[model samples]
Target: MTMLRTMGADRFNYNVFKKKMSKEPLYPTQECSYKMRIEMLDSYLTNQKTVDVSSYFKPGHLVIVDLRDPSTNASLVIALFKIIVGLFVKQRMETGKVLLLDKAHKYLNSDPCSARFTVSMTSLIRQQQHFGIRTIIPTQEPAVVPDAILDLVFFLVLHCFNFPTWMRNLRRHISVNQDRGESEGG
Candidate 1:
């Protein structure tokens, strides 16, 4: 027993272990969640790696929602999103690392289960600023995003203003509410 203890004694350095497991700020400052657009100039370049952007993300660090496979169903994505969001919120409240969800529309959709989760975003709005739960969703067609998620967004970053007529009308309503200093439906 003494020999075994001596052999194992060198492996357990509390200080080093603590530092490795410390729940400190893991991601870079100011680069929270975002939706990025990748434009491939040529058809051959579609599968090529344009840039290595992995440094921005930490390993075992970000919860990724991969719905690229055709077999991946909406129900599964909805369930996963709900779980991931809860985890992200808990981590944000405990630590300070905000999780990023790029192209959230891919994961969250208008399915029945997804709609149920969307309704839960009301509570999320209340704790957004407190827990630093920031989400950046970019879509060419904004109609794909659920209206519940839109209500919680305080800032809007539109790269192009050439919106469809329906979207323009929606923007008009949003602008009116903003001008009156109203929190959407709140």
Candidate 2:
């Protein structure tokens, strides 16, 4: 009879070797190594080729909602408004790179009822613009936001000049097209 000896088994030696190798660092411990990895990820995203939004969304698949109601709950109102605007911005960023906000005066004006809501909304819009997001705000109320902020708007719709002074102020930044042909050409 032969005595069983496990001490020199090849399986045991293999396991011991793996355990030793696992304890050794596979990567450098320097902070710069970690930073370089993050930078690579960011560069990948920035350099990604642009794709058509139609590939992701079907034609005529857009939803628009009005959040001008004063009776709606503040939190619910803000959340829904954010969802709509977020979708618009996402689509714009992916495809068009531009968005038009019609009747923006309603939000920019300082109404006694929706002052907080307007302030928060304006802040978000401004932040989005700062990040290379293009927004066209067509509003008759020139006093709502500072002139510098309004200057970012590339297009303006000047119609029915109920306020001549406001029209004049807007004219400084945007050209007024009284003729429909001129507006269409623009």
Candidate 3:
């Protein structure tokens, strides 16, 4: 409202300076390629009671960003997850921090958005030790897991993985048994 209603008058009551100055704009909205996409983020820019992230991300609070809607886009989830993870790392207590991604196979696929998200997650995984962070990703489909993430993962807590072909694909990314399908984490 202030940006649209900005008015400056002189001592003589003359409203002369009223041009939208590009050199010194009233509002500081930046000029970027993804400006439209950035503005589209509801959690980042909203005035209603819908923005509940800031208050929940406090110490000793288990903030769970669960978008259970099956129709939700992967890119949107990736963006929100990235933002939340970044904030969580910055404000985490000295004790440590944990980032759990349940059913990550949905977004850890071969799509462009998924690839970019995989890169971001792989970077986070590499710096986990330095930032006192631990990431736990539980996926029902191991085939969808990216190679970048598989190479960096320290452990794989598989439950009832009784298929031989599953181990064959799993062995391609990380070391595991060939015949009996055993995953001995490196």
Largest TM-score belongs to which candidate? Answer: 3
lDDT winner among the candidates?
Answer: 3
- lDDT (0 to 1) per candidate: 0.49, 0.48, 0.64
Q: Which ten-residue region of model 3 has the weakest summed lDDT?
A: 8-17
lDDT of 3 at 120: 83
Q: Can you write out model 1's per-residue Cα lDDT over 29-115, one digit (the tens) per residue?
A: 312311111122123223544421222234346545554545445655555455446545544233355545566665456767666
Residue-wise lDDT of candidate 2 within 63-152, one digit each (tens)? Answer: 345555554444445444544455445443333344456665554545653465465455655676554455666665665654555565
Residue 44, model 1, lDDT: 25
Model 3 per-residue lDDT tens digits across residues 67-185: 55654466667765666666566655767777899988888888898888788889989999888889999877877788888888798887977665667777777766545424443
Model 3 clashing residue pairs (backbone): none
Worst 10 residues of 2 by lDDT: 1-10
Model 3 TM-score on a 0 to 1 scale: 0.64
RMSD of 2: 21.3
**lDDT head-to-head 1 vs 3, winner:** 3
TM-score of each: 0.51, 0.41, 0.64
